[model samples]
Each structure stands twice: as structure tokens, then as C-alpha cells.
Target: MDAMDVDYLNELLEQDVEIREKIKQQVSDLDKKVRVMVGILIKIHSTPTDTLPPLLDSVRPILRSCHDTSAALASLVPPNQFWRWKEMWSNSLRTAVYSAALVEYLSSGSLITLSQASEVLGIKEEWADRFSIAVEDYLHGLISLVNELSRLAVNAVTLGDYEAPLRISVFVKDIFAGFSMLNLKNDTLRRRFDSLKYDLKKIEEVVYDVSLRKLTDSTKSAVRK
Candidate 1:
């Protein structure tokens, strides 16, 4: 309308553009690092269970870099505006959460909690209101982990580590049970949760195959004796 009003609006638009560009750059960098970590972590399918600890350890520094980049991105957003620009980094953040969770699971055979995920991403307690992993993102990451574990189950069988599949089966079932208790209203999250059953089935199949094979071998040994 008036020149003063138009100038003020233009200034606001310029600031928004500048902030968006910075956030995008950080998201892009984070996405690249996440891809690298995923590439490394996926090797768990072929890697022996005994060697996995070192493999996970290799990505520790990269995970720290991810935390640094996330902090930088958070700094660029105005306080309380995190949700507004969250979409730009949401996917990357979910993948980062998944990566951290995968590493923890591989190391200890347990799920990574939200606080641990936040700690992995280097989000401080004071910044919880401004920037943190939403419950939805954490659920999405766990779903991704289930999918990965299903694949790992099949690969573990091929690698002759039948025990890993059994462990994965139990872990996946536990995660699915946890999801069963939640009232997931988000469409994407609900859909992802639906897919968990298929992962569980695949893992269960691996466990069955491993069990049958072990039983057959035991019977053969008895017959020989």
C-alpha cells in the first residue's frame, strides 16, 4: 500500500530469504554426512557381529560433525520459529536419528531413547524448547531401523551368524510392541508403523530358518553318534 509499508515488507522478505538459504545449506551438508554414515552402517548386513563394534566406532566423528552442523542450523533460526523451518531439515534430522540409533543398537542390541537421540545430535537441555527431535521423527527413525534390521536378518543368515537374526527378531518385536501402544495420528508415521509387521515377519522367517537348520544339524549329529 504505502511506500513505508512496502519497504518494511520487502525488508522482512529479504531477511526470510537469507535465513532460509543458510538453513538449506546446513541441511544439505547434514544430508551428505548422513548418507555417508548410512553407507557405512548398511555394511552391517555383510559384516560379522564381532567386527561391528569397530565399524560403528568409525562413524563416531562423523556423528559428532552432524551434531555440530545441527547446532549451527539451530542457531540460524529465530527462537520459537524452529517449527516453521523444521520441514527443511526434518528428513535429514530423522535420518541422523536413525543413524545414531543404528549405531547404538549394533553396539548394545537396544533401542536408542529420545534423550539419547537428542544427545547424539548435540541438542543441549536449554535448547529443548527451541530445537529438538519431535516424537514423530523419533518414531520414523525407529521404523527405518526396523526395516534395516529385517535386511540384516537375512544377511546374517547368509553370513552364518544365526544368533544375530534371533536377537534382531526379538528386538524388532519389542519395538513393534512399543509402537502398538502409541496413538499415532500422523498419517506418515501411521503408515510407517504399518510396515513394521512386514519387517517383523521377515525377521521371524529368518529366525525360523536358522532354528530349523540348527535342529536338523543336531539330529544329524545324533544319528552319526
Candidate 2:
């Protein structure tokens, strides 16, 4: 090729490299912040269920930082590079979803909607609507919550907190019913949704076991009368 063509190609390659490097740095920072939020959430999840309120209160600011950093990173990603970087930030969305749902469940024992997740992340619902990092991505996080809740239901029963399992069972069924109506084309989300049935079964089993134990005890008590 001619020298002019060679120089122009080299310049374009250099620009592309620079853009990638910048995006890498921003994604790295965003990933780090998200990991911290996830760590705190893990701690909260491990805590006794009754003690989660204060732990959630402590998590709010870190979660806010994660949201802010992720939004900044999203803005910095050039339109041409969005498809390239979108997967990299899915972790952030996952953590945001799990955290939001946990906070809502802890507060009210209910499933959180996408709009509620947007409010938790402190981002505009409109901004999250058309972007790859939108509330739809957070929907996957709800799947994670279902998995967690199933485990929590078992643990609650072991700890003699029978009511918690029933509550979790109902919430999980509600979430599963809602997910069934969505026309998800994203393969990753579709696969994740597929796992919800297993989580639903696990929670139902826990609830059944708890209810059976209650019935057995009541029957024995009546026999003693």
C-alpha cells in the first residue's frame, strides 16, 4: 500500500487502541465499586434475618456510589463501543438488582418491580429504558434473589422461623408468575429465568416441611387432651 494509506490506517488503529484502553479503565473502576457493593450485600445476607435492617442502612451509600460510577461509565462508553462494554457492566446490574430486592423484601416482604430497582439505583427510569444497562438487566438480579430466598427459606426453617419460609414461598411464586409473562429474547436472561422453577420448588418444599411439622405437633397436642 502507499505511505499515505499506511499512515492513515496506523492512526486509526492507534485511536481505536486509545479508546479501548480508556473504556477498560472505566470498566475496571466500575467493576471494583460493584464488587464492594456485592461484598457488603453478602455480609448482609449472611447476617441474622432480624438484623438486616441496620445492615441495609449501611449499604445504601456504597450502593449509591456504585450506581453513580456505573452511570458515569455508561456515559463515557462511546456509542460505537457500547455493545463491546455492555457485558462487562452486567455484574454491576446484577449486584444492583440483588441489593434492591433484598432491601425491599427485608422492608416489606414483597417482590420489587423494575421501577423500584431504578429508584434504588438512583437513576432515571427513562435512561434505563433503552440502554443495555437498563432495568431489564436488573430483572436478572431478581432471579438471583429467588435463588437466595430459597436458601434463606431453608435456613429460616432450621432456625425455627417457620413464618419466613411461607413468606418467601409466596414472594417467589409471585415473582415466578410475573417472569412467565415477559417475552425475553436475550438468551442469557432466558436461561436464568429457566432456573426459577427450581428455586420455586425448593422454596415450596421448605414451606411444606414447615407446615407439616406444625400439623404433626398440633395433632399430637390434641391427642394429649
Candidate 3:
């Protein structure tokens, strides 16, 4: 092309590269934070059910820090260009959503909604158009949560907490039923959803063992006596 056109194109390419680098750095930082949160939350498998509140509580500030980092990353993208650069931070954001969902599920016995995930990530209302968790990301996060809860069910049994496995089994099955109704079109998400049944099966096994052994009954009788 002409010299002037080439110069303009070159400038645009340089700007794009610069922005990509910044986004990469921000995403790296966010990934580290997500890892830290994951490390903390994964301990739930070994932790007692009653003491889980504090363990879940410990991640709040870190999640808030993640929110700050997420906001900074969002700032790096130009308005209306979030989808263009979304893949750069998609994995990290999904992990962050998983962490948030795990904390909520453990704290309460319920699933975290999309709006709640957005709140946990500190995506303010004004940033909705520019930055938000995709539905696929939220579903992926929930799938991760189900996987974790499956492991937690086995561990809870080891800890003599038979009730947890039953609770987890019901919750996960409910989630699985909900997922069954979705018309998932994304290949990766559909594949991930397919794996969820195995996790549910693991939880069911744990629940069955707990029931077969009458552990819940014994615990209840002991409490009643």
C-alpha cells in the first residue's frame, strides 16, 4: 500500500501489541491469585464440616483482590472490545468463578447464581456491557464445583461426616438435572458437562456406602440418645 497507509497500519499494530502485553501481564497476575484461592479452597476436602465456615471466610479478601485485578484487566480493553480480548482472561475468570461458587456452596448449601458470581468478582453495573462472566463460564465453574464436591463427599465420609455426602449427592444431582435441560452448543462445555455424570456417580457411591453402613443412622441415634 501507500507509505501513509503503511505507517498508520504499523502504528495500529504496535498499539495492539502493547495492549496485548499489558493484558497478558494482568491475566498472569489474576491467574496467580486464582491459584492461591484454589489452593486454599481445595483444603475443604480434608477440613471438618463445622470448621468450613472459617476456611471459606479466609478467601473473601483474596476474592476482593481478584475483583480489583479483574477490574484493572477490564480497564485495559477498549470499550466494546471485551469479546475480542476475552479469551486472554477466560480461563482465569472461569477459575475465579469456580472459586467463588465453591465458597458460596460450602458456606451455604446452594448454588451460586450468575448475578452472585458477578458480584463476587466485583463486576459493577456500569461494567456490565464491557465486562461480565459468560453463561458458559459460570456453568463451567459449577461443573468444577461438582467435581470438587464429589471428592469432598469421599473425604467427608473419611472424616465421619456421613450427612455431608447425602447433602452433596442431592445437590449435585439437582445440578445435573438442571444441566440436562440446557441446549449446550459449545463443544468444550458440552464435553465438560458430559463428565459431570461421573462426578455425580462418585457422590452417589459415597452416599450409598454411608447409607449401607448405617453411619447416618448411628450418628442420629447417638445424638438422640
Candidate 4:
């Protein structure tokens, strides 16, 4: 590796550290938030219909922002479908907690077993298999997107360009839009999608860090030689 590669490596280290900190902070906050929401749901369980809207309204954004952007960066790894965990929670704030777990997982570039997800969603063993399959399918598309985008990013950087994939973002936006429409029809499903959106973002951000580190190291090595 040359000086350029070294520089790039250093930059990536910094970026990785930064992302780790951000992920940690976000996870801590999300945990507290989920607990509060769960308490609220329990308090208003008898009148779930009334508590549901306010709960959804308050938690919607957290659900929206937890997307797995790293999947886009990597191409082969599908975006983990945090939303699909909704099968366990079934129309409460389960969407939000799932998103939180998902973001935490994506941020770490880890695989979440169906059992873990099922447990988090309070789902039983029999139904978890079906829901796990659905999550995997959804994750497949995300992984494809991430892998393709990663290829694009690698090629672009090699060619001396480094712009975020706005086109890919548009694609993600459109898909989410469809889900949004679906949300309007069924609140449970909608919240599930919302969780997915946020989880993907976290994934993408981590993938970006990985790429930048690779690039920075590559460049620094070249610079040194």
C-alpha cells in the first residue's frame, strides 16, 4: 500500500469509529424510547384503538429513519427486513422496536436470526418460519440493490469520482412510497414498512463507511508509492 492507501485507511478508521459511536448513541436512545412506548401501549391496552394513533404518530419517524443503507453499499447482502418483524407485534408499536433492533443489527453488519427477531416480536415458533421467509425475500431485494450500488461506487471511485448514488436513493424512495400507500390501508403493515425504512438507512450509512475506508486506504497506498 502507498501513502494514498494509508491515508484512505486512516480515514476509514475514523469513519468506522464515528459510525460506531453514532450507532451506539442511537441504540441507547431507541431502547429508552421503545420502553416508554411499550409502557404507553400497556397503559392503554383496553383502549388500544385510541392509544394506537398517537403512538404511531410519535414513533413514525424513528420507524422511517432506521433503513439499512449498507445493503446498498455491499450489493450481495440484502437489506434486512426489519419491518417484517411486525408479524410478532401485530399492529402495536412492535414496528418501532423491530426497527430499533434492525438498525442496531445493520449498523453492526450482523445477521439477525429468525429466532431472535421472532423473540423480539413476541412471535411463536410456528408462525415465525413464515414471517422469517417474508423478511428474507424483502432482504433479498435490498441486498441486490446494495450489491449493485457497491459495484457502482467501487467503479466510480476507481475512475476518480465519488458521488452518492442519488439514482439508487430514488429507487428506494419509490419503493417506500408504495409501502406508504399500503400503510394507509393497514396501520400494522405500514408501521412495519416504516421500521424497514430506518433500518435500511443505517445499513447504507455503514456500507458507505466501509467503501470510503477501502477507497481511502487504496488511495493512500498509491500516494505513498
Candidate 5:
């Protein structure tokens, strides 16, 4: 190649690196904010309803900040490369956690639907078209919530909150059913879907065990009375 050609290629390469680095920093800050929200969600998940509003309130501003960063990233990255860039942001799991938390909080611990996720993310049709962002991004996050709820079920039962396991079992089963209906193409998402069955089974077992214990306790009480 000519010297000018070589220099041109080098300059392009440097610009590409700079762009990636800038995106990395932005995404890193976004992820940190997401992490704080996730931490609050963990506390909220275990604590009683009375403790939730303040924690959830704390998350809204952070979520808005995340939304702004996401919009900026979407604008900066090429359409073809946006999905890949989103994966690199590594926010899917936390985003899903946030969605799950918001839905549960709003509905008194019920799972949220896709439409509700749009509401939670404050994503409108116009904004989605403008930013080229997909609702599937939030839906993908819900997959992570299934895993979390399964673990939560086991822990809830252990903590003597048997009702929690029942709720989780029903919710996880619904989520798994919904996932089964989709024609998911992403390898990571598909694999995560496959793994959900294990969580479903674990939560089911906990529910069964809790039911059996309650049954036994009732029988003992009847026998004594």
C-alpha cells in the first residue's frame, strides 16, 4: 500500500478504537448505576412491602439516567452494530432485574407483562423508532428475572414465607410458558431459556415441600384439638 493509504488506514483504526473506548466508559457508568438499582431491588425483594417504596423511589432517577445513556449509545452506534454494542454494555441482567422488581412492586409481587415493561422503561413507540431500540431488550432482561425468582423461592421458603414459594412457582411457570412460545434466535437467550426449566423444577419442589409441611401441621393441630 502507498504511505498515504497506510496513514489513512491507521487514522481510521485509531478513530474506531477511540469510539469503542468512549462507549465502554459510558456503558461502564451506566452499568454502575444499574448495579445500585439491582442492589436496592435485592433488599426490596426480601423485605416487606413497607420497605419497598423508598427503595423503588431511589431507583427511578437511576433508571432515567440509564435511559438517557441508552439513547446516547443507540444514537452513537450504527444500527447494524447496535445490538452487538448493547450486548457489550452487559446491562441485560440488571435491566431484567429492574423490570421484575418494578412489576412486582407495582402489582404487589406479580410478574409484569411486556407492555408493562415499556411503561416501566418509559419507552414510547416514537422513542423506540427514533432510537432504534427494541422491546426485546427488556424482554430479554425478564429472562434473568426467572432465574432470580427461582432462587428467591427457595430462600423465601427457608425463611418461613411459604406463600412466596407458591407465588414464585406460579410466576416462573408462566414466564417459562411465555418463553416457550417465542422463536428466540439469540444463542445466549435460548440457552438461558433452557436453563429456566431447572429453576422451575426447584421452585416446584419447594412449593410441594411447603404444602406438605402445612398439611402435616394442620393434621397435627386437628389431632391435638
Candidate 6:
């Protein structure tokens, strides 16, 4: 990367921060509303699974009412950042947005259940199909980005390659830490976690939990005891 590239990363970071702030502002009043909605969703799902059409219908107004932020997000990144690393930043932005949303989504258990996500997202109907495709496409891109980023540790850098396992560990940790940026969605964020597993989601859960602990103190859990 050149000076321009460094500038690009900085610019992108600034944009992300700005967008994060905007989202924070947007969702400011949603706390109690979102909690109530989730409670109703849980009640509806507890007994008979309410068919998705009805459920999705119930949520549609809120989803549709969401203030479109494409313009604001666009405003965050400048011409220099967008012009040069458009594709990279786009993928990064999707990763950042979804991950930001995911942190909030997961913590509050507000995410459509995986089953519901599959149900609504899998419909062959034109409207839902496109939405599903977009999310899947972005998710695949995120997976690819992680793979590429992992290889960066092995990529030749200014001096030698990133030889230190400590550095690699730090890089991995930073990736998990970035999820905390989603706290901009809600100020009083709590650490969330699940059992450690090899799957990407599971691994992230572990890190999310650990990150919360580490934030309060320097000590943390170990992979092996």
C-alpha cells in the first residue's frame, strides 16, 4: 500500500465512525420500542409458530420506517476513499454494517431466529428473494474478506512478513474487537457469548464474551486450561 492507501484506510475509518454516530442517533429512541417488539415476537413464537407473512407484516412498518441511511453512509466516505478502494471498502462497509447490526441484533435476541431468517429470506417470491440474495452475497464477501485478511499476516510488508504469532493473535483479536463498534447502536451494551466451537459464528461468540470480560479487566479466559 502507498501513502494514498494509508490515507484511504484512515478515511474509511473516519466514515465508519461517522456512520456509527448517525446510526446511534437514529436508534436513540428505539430501545424501549425494540424491547417490546422482541417480547411480542417471543410470545407469538412460543406456542404456535405464527406464519411468517403475518409476523413479517407486523414488523414491516418498523423496518420500512427505518430512516434510509444510504445517503449518510455515502457522505461518510470521501471521494478519495471511494474512488480508489471502492470494492474493498464496499465489502468492508457491508461487513461493518451487518456486524454492527448483528451485535445489536444478537444481544437483544432481536434477530429473526435462524429459522425465521431462513423462512423469510428463502422465499422464492421476487421481493424476498432479492433481499435474501443480497444478504447472502454480502455474507460470502465477508467470508472471503476474512480469508484474505488472514493471509495478510503472511503477506510481505514494509520490512519482513508479519512473523510474530503475537501479531497474528492481535490481528485476530482486533477483528473481534471491531464488533464492539456496534455499541454505538446502544450505549449500555453488554457482552454476549455462547459455547466455543470451530464454526465462525461460535468462534465469534467466544470472542464477544471474552471481549466483555477483558474490557473490565486485563485478565481473561484461556483456550486451554
Clashing pairs in 2: none
lDDT of 1 at 98: 94
Compose the digit string of candidate 1's lDDT tens values, residues 1-225: 999999999999999999999988988999999999999998898898888888999888899987788688778888888688888888998999999999999888889999999998887776655567888999899999999989998998788776788788889989999999999999989999998989998888877887766633544576679
Assess candidate 5 and give its lDDT.
0.66
Cα-based lDDT at residue 135, candidate 5: 47
TM-score of 1: 0.94
Q: Give the alpha carbon lDDT tens digit for every residue of 106-203 in model 2.
A: 78887777777766766564443223445457787888888888888877766656678778887888888988999998898999999898989988
Displacement of residue 135 (Cα, Å) in model 4 is: 5.4
Task: Please give the CA lDDT of all the candidate structures.
Answer: 0.87, 0.73, 0.88, 0.42, 0.66, 0.36
Alpha-carbon TM-score of each model against the true structure:
0.94, 0.80, 0.94, 0.26, 0.75, 0.26
Candidate 5 wrong stretches, greater than 4 Å: 90-110, 113-119, 122-140, 158-160, 215-225
Question: Residue 197 in candidate 1 has what lDDT?
Answer: 87
Lowest lDDT block of 10, candidate 3 = 123-132
Per-residue lDDT tens digits of candidate 6, residues 29-84?
Answer: 33333444444434322222223345534654443322233333344444444343
Candidate 3 local lDDT, 127-223, one digit each (tens): 6556778888889989998988889999998988889998998899999999999999999999999999899888888887877777897656866
Expressed as tens digits, the lDDT of each residue in 1-225 for candidate 5 is: 999999999998897787788788766776787777777777744665445577777777766666566566656665456454555654543474455455463447676665565555444444443333354665567777776777777766655566777777777787789889999988877887798889899988887887777633544576679
1-225 per-residue lDDT for model 4 (tens digits) = 999999999998886576445544544554555565445433322332223355545544534432231111122212353342323322222334344343333234343444554444343444332222244334333333333333443344444443333333444455556545542444544454556566457446644764566545544576679
Error of 6 at 3 (Å): 25
**Pairwise lDDT winner, candidates 1 and 4:** 1
For candidate 3, what is the lDDT?
0.88
TM-score of 3: 0.94
Off by over 4 Å in 3: 218-225
- Model 1 residue 46 distance off true place after TM-score fit, in angstroms: 1.3
Per lDDT, what order, best first?
A: 3, 1, 2, 5, 4, 6
Clashes of 4: 46
